[model samples]
Target chain A: MKKWVPTVIFLAVAVVLIVLAIVFLPVSKSVWVWIAALLTLAIFSILYRDNPIYRIAEHIFVGLSLGYGLAMIWHLALWQIALRPLFVEGRFILIIPIAIGLLYFTRLIPKVSWLVRIPISIALGLGSGIAIPLIFQATIFEQTKASLVLPEMFAPGNPWPGIWAIILIIGIVTTLAYFFFSRKEKSVLSPVSKVGIIFIMLGFGATFGLTVMSRVSLLIGRVQFLLREWLGIIAQ
Target chain B: MKRRIPLTLTLVLGIVMMIQFFIPHQFSQDFKNTALEWLRVIGGFAFIIGLASFITHHYTKIKHKKEGWAYSPIALGALVVMAVVGLIGRSPNMNWIPVTVQGQQISVFTYLFSNFFTHMMIPLGATMFSVLAFYIASAAYRSFRAKSLVSILLLVAAFVIMLAIIFYNVLPLGDLGEWLLSVPNMAAKRGILLGASLGGIATSLKIILGIERGYLGGTK
Candidate 1:
């Protein structure tokens, strides 16, 4: 009886919402718009408690995601990735990746599952081979180069500004040294490393603040739903 | 068949996604785009699944009269009410309900999602996250000992970064803050980024190769 009370009320309100949506929104817009709002709250409820309702919602989400993924793979990969080049462009070389991707389906077979690894290996080897150098160039080389090399003083006559540049260079060097786990620091090098540590904390704090903001945004959404949607005190 | 097929397909698609990045052929490019689209669709569907799970889980708890089971009704009530409004308020004909007036077509849902979801959830999420500040401050207060070399380094860095950002608007202080962010700060961040990228690459490779099967459900 206690259970029925909420379920019944929920069903009643849901019916009203459905009726209102169908009558008002464009057919395409209505279903998705409400579904998106409801699901967002449902996910957020995980923070309060873990229950069967959340699990059911979770599984349905998984199945839907999987199905959607399958559809896109068909539309994009089978047609665009593998088939188009093979037939339309006559790019026969495309067969290699096509074959490799197809090999992934081998896991369905009991004895031949191991065959999937060959293609997987080629993907990893090629991906890393390209990625490593690109990462080094963009992040390591570019960032360090900018930091180490300064512009010629804007005012050549001003010594005070160049003094700042010298200090900046010193700071950058000592900070880098602070990260070295293996090095034994003697004397002033120790203090320089100390300054480096403070900079790292500030970066972490800013990122944390941004993450908090996104979460707060999600909570605000649910509260608004309870007041405006269920109560209906607020007019549209 | 289900298990094998899913496993194989996951492996194949996963590998293709990784390799496509390097190869740059039209096929690879298409694969990447398709994979991204597929992920989005899957993510959307996952949202519905989440809703369903919420209802089922809470309903069961309420049924069993478990501790805190009373709250289940509130959750189930919320889910059903929202789902119905979403569905019924979506049709074109004279429809069972006339939620909208002539030119200003509106429904409870439009009211809910637009007004409620955005204004409420977003801010709540941000505030919940802000609670981290108290936790961080308390943790630092208790744990920030200046005992050793590494600890000292950490303490000083923490102090400078905090002081620089907080006192940034002042004359020489602002200048110090800018220098801190641009030079020493940037250098340390880069070093951290370098190490992290190396780790990410290794993990991505492992996952693509199926060597990292933990994500696939453990030691079976």
Candidate 2:
């Protein structure tokens, strides 16, 4: 009875909300909106406590995403790349890809599972090879080039640009120096590393604030949907 | 033999792909395109393995009657329903269970998919993430204590950023917050990115040269 109390109370509140929504919502009502609101509430019930309703919603989400991904891959990849060319266009060369793709299913059989490594190796190799130069060009080279502040930044009337450029250069140097594990923290590197810690903290703080704001906006969206769209309590 | 063949394939393919990036010839582009197409097909089949693992895991849970096993059936049922509806609805000529709503023709499969995705998936996804707002607040309260100078700096920076975002018009700290982000934050981020990229390049080189044989299955 103790366990059932919360569930019963939740159901009663949900039923009352649904009834209110049905009665007060605009005449041009979307059943989808009602279902969405209920699902949102069902998921939010996890905040109160772990219950069967939240578990079911979570599991259903997992399964549905998997199914949706499969359907998209079937239509987008297999049909377009392999089947259409093999059957409709008489391109027998597609047999190579189809065979390679079929090797992926060999993972299901214990003895032949080693065959799965063939495709995996190819994919990983290609990915690694392609990423090496790109990462160097984009992240390392471009970022270092951008960090070099020219003296022209200080030539103009507006001095904030030059000031910010100096701060950026210092920040980048100190942050990089903090990660230098080759040498011990001597007197010279000690203060620089401390400065690096400050910049790192500031960066993380900004990231956390942005993340919280984003999550809060999502909450606000659900609240707005519940109030204005579902309950008609607020004017649109 | 199994491991050697795969390792050789990795080395050869990695070298070819790397070289192809430098070559702007038509043939090189065509080769890359064909290889990518093959990769896509293989990727699709890879998901089948994932789906199989999912089903097996859930089936075992339900079979053992584990705690909350009742929800397993719901999940499996949803998976089957969504898959069937999505696959059938994607076809252009799917005429089964046709219905006209307000003079527009639509299939039952399409309607089911729309309802399932918009009502079930979207709301669940949004609400799941929104729940993090409460957790973030709790975490911030616990971690924002100013015990040391570094901690105090972190707390102050976070407070300034949050306040600036909420009351940018009412307050004058927004410009300072923006400057902090664009200058020091960006610099630190770029430094981290440069370090990570260098590490990634090293790992990639190791993999391509067959020094990292981790991806290969266990030896017989």
Candidate 3:
């Protein structure tokens, strides 16, 4: 009865809000807008407590996304590349790929599950091979090159750029030293590594601040949707 | 036979793919394209297997009347409805189904798809993420306590960044926050990126050389 009381009160309040939205809001005529507004509220209801309405909306979201993705994959990939070429265009060469792709289904059969490894091997091998050179080129080499600040940064009058460049170089060295686990804790690199940790913490703090801001913005958006779009309580 | 063949395929294909990156020949490009096309088709089949697994899992839960069993039917119903609408609505040239409503030349399937995605999916997804705001606020309160020198520095940095972002013109902390981000933060980020990339390359090489056989499953 205690749980039921809150549930009943919440529902009563929700009904009142919906009634106000329909009667006062300009967008009341658009059925889609009302649906969207209700769905948004239903999702937000999870904050109060898990209920059947929120669960239903959550399940539907997952199912719809999965189904939409499958339909797209069929039309974009399987039909276009494998089926159409093999049947309509009479490209017999596609049969090899189609045959290999069929091996992916061998997982459903215990006796022939080993066949699935072939396709997995091919995919893993290609993906890893592609990643190696690209990762090196993009992250390691480029970042190292960018870190090498030029002497021109120290050119006359503009001391701030030079100071920043020096600080960055020191921060990079210390951060790398911190990650280098090759040496003992009592070694000469220990102090530098400790400095590295400070920079890392500062970086993490900035990241957390930015993340909080982004999440708050999303909350603000939903609030604006409710107040301005649904209830017309706030001016545009 | 099972293990040896797959490992050999990994080794050969991995080397070929790596070498093809350096090669500028037309044959090499064609080989890469064919490999990509094969990967796409195989990926589609993999997605089907995943979908089958999802449906089977839900069906089993419903059969056993599990804790959240009541929601399974809604999920299954939504999947079927969306799949039917998306597949049928995409093919407007089929000319079998009526594609007009109330004198407006609109595909009903397309309209349903757009409505479901916009009204149902987008709102739900966006609101779901928005719930994180309250949780993040609570977490920040618990974590931002100044216990030591390092913790104090971290808390100060966070406060500065947050204030700068929210009221850049009102406060002079924006330039300080920007400086912190561009210099020290960027340096640390670059260092981490370099280390991770090196680690990734090592793992990729290990996989290619068949040292990482965990991906082959525990069958053999």
Candidate 4:
């Protein structure tokens, strides 16, 4: 009774949901929309606590999500991939991908784990190759460009601002030096790195403050829902 | 046989996917998309495993009459009803009358989700996350002490930034705040990014070369 009861109940429900999702969901806009919403709510119940209901619903959710994903892939990729390109066009390039893709499944075998690296190497090399140049452009050159200054200032500019700029330049250079992990710093870079540490803490403090506000916003959203929707009474 | 075939396929597929990104050909893009789709399917199956475990865990809990097992019925009921409603609603040929009139299937599900799920779940999560605020405040008060030159620099910069936010009168200090963010912060952020990039590249290389067999769960 323990095992079979839940299985029977779950299977029955699963069948109904599958039928609803495949057929009726496309017909009635308002009804199926709410069904979708309810399904979301049902799964979310786990946040409060776990129970058979939540477990069953969560399982169904997993099943449905998986089933949908597979269906979409079959619809969109299978014909275009294995059949249209490789089988139809007879392109030799197609074999390369087929071979590489096959490498990912090798983990299932006890001895062929080493063969998996062939594909892993290519992916890593390409990802890094793209990232290196992009990083140099986005970080080093752009920052240097922003820090550029003219000897002459606009007519109404104060020298005080320029003095601050010199301080800022000092801070930037020293702070970057702090992160130079490879070499030991015994020169002026040591004190400069110390100055950089100060800047890092201040920056982190401000970010922590901002995160607090976002969290508050999320809480208010829940409180508002409970009071206004469930109880049907809330202060404006 | 299962192990050998799947492993062989993985090797060939992984290589193809890696090269696809750089191939600049239509076939390559199609192959990449297919690989992503397959990964999504696998991920979906993982979720089903989770659900099965959940049922097993709860069923045992209820049967053993564990503490707080009474709530199991409510949870089980909710799961069953949801599944039924979902199934019924999924059927196009079931006739909308039973759904609309008898059970009010759609509205019942909608009410259950909105009144219960969003109202309860989202807020609870948001509240748990918000606890970090009070924690931060206390931490700052206790730990942000200045005993040396570096600490003092940090203290002053933080004070200036905080003052800029709360009081409108500190107009001049706003420039100090801006300087702290754009100049020093930018430099540190860039350095961190560079280091992270290097780490990611290294990890990716390890995974590709089969040096990082950890992902495949200890060599099988």
Q: By the lDDT metric, which is better: model 1 or model 3?
A: 3
Candidate 2 clashing pairs?
none
lDDT of 2 at B132: 97
Error of 2 at A169 (Å): 2.3
What are the Cα lDDT values of the candidates? Answer: 0.52, 0.84, 0.84, 0.53
lDDT by residue (A28-120, candidate 2, tens digit) is 277887778778888899999998778878888987887788778888999888998899999999998788878988887899889999988
Q: What is the descending TM-score order?
A: 2, 3, 4, 1
DockQ of each: 0.10, 0.75, 0.71, 0.11
Q: Indicate the docking level reached by candidate 3.
A: medium
Runs of candidate 1 exceeding 4 Å displacement: A1-236, B1-11, B22-28, B46-53, B80-104, B145-167
- Per-residue lDDT for B185 in model 2? 84
Better of 2 and 4 by lDDT: 2
Q: Write the per-residue lDDT of candidate 4 for residues A92-191, one digit (tens) a residue.
A: 5556655664565564475776555544444443444444445456755776666555565322657755565565566556656777666575875787
Interface RMSDs of the predictions, in order, are 8.6, 1.3, 1.5, 7.6
| Each prediction's TM-score versus the true structure | 0.52, 0.94, 0.93, 0.55
Per-residue lDDT tens digits for candidate 1, residues B1-220, read 4234434555565555555667858986776665543343333333444454555676788788987665556545544444444333332332453256456666655445343334333433343453344456667778778787655655655665556556667677667556555655555566577557656667765655556654333323
TM-score result, candidate 1: 0.52
- Model 3 regions more than 4 Å off: A2-5, A24-27, B92-104
Poorest 10 consecutive residues by lDDT, candidate 3 chain B:
B90-99
Ranking by DockQ: 2, 3, 4, 1
Per-residue lDDT of model 1, residues A1-236, tens digit only: 66446545654675787577557643334343355445544544444455444444444344333333333444445555566667989978666566655565565576776655544444444444445556666776776675553556436777655565555555556656666556675855677767666545544443333343444444555555544554333553
lDDT of 4 at B47: 39
Across the candidates, what are chain A's individual TM-scores? 0.66, 0.90, 0.89, 0.59
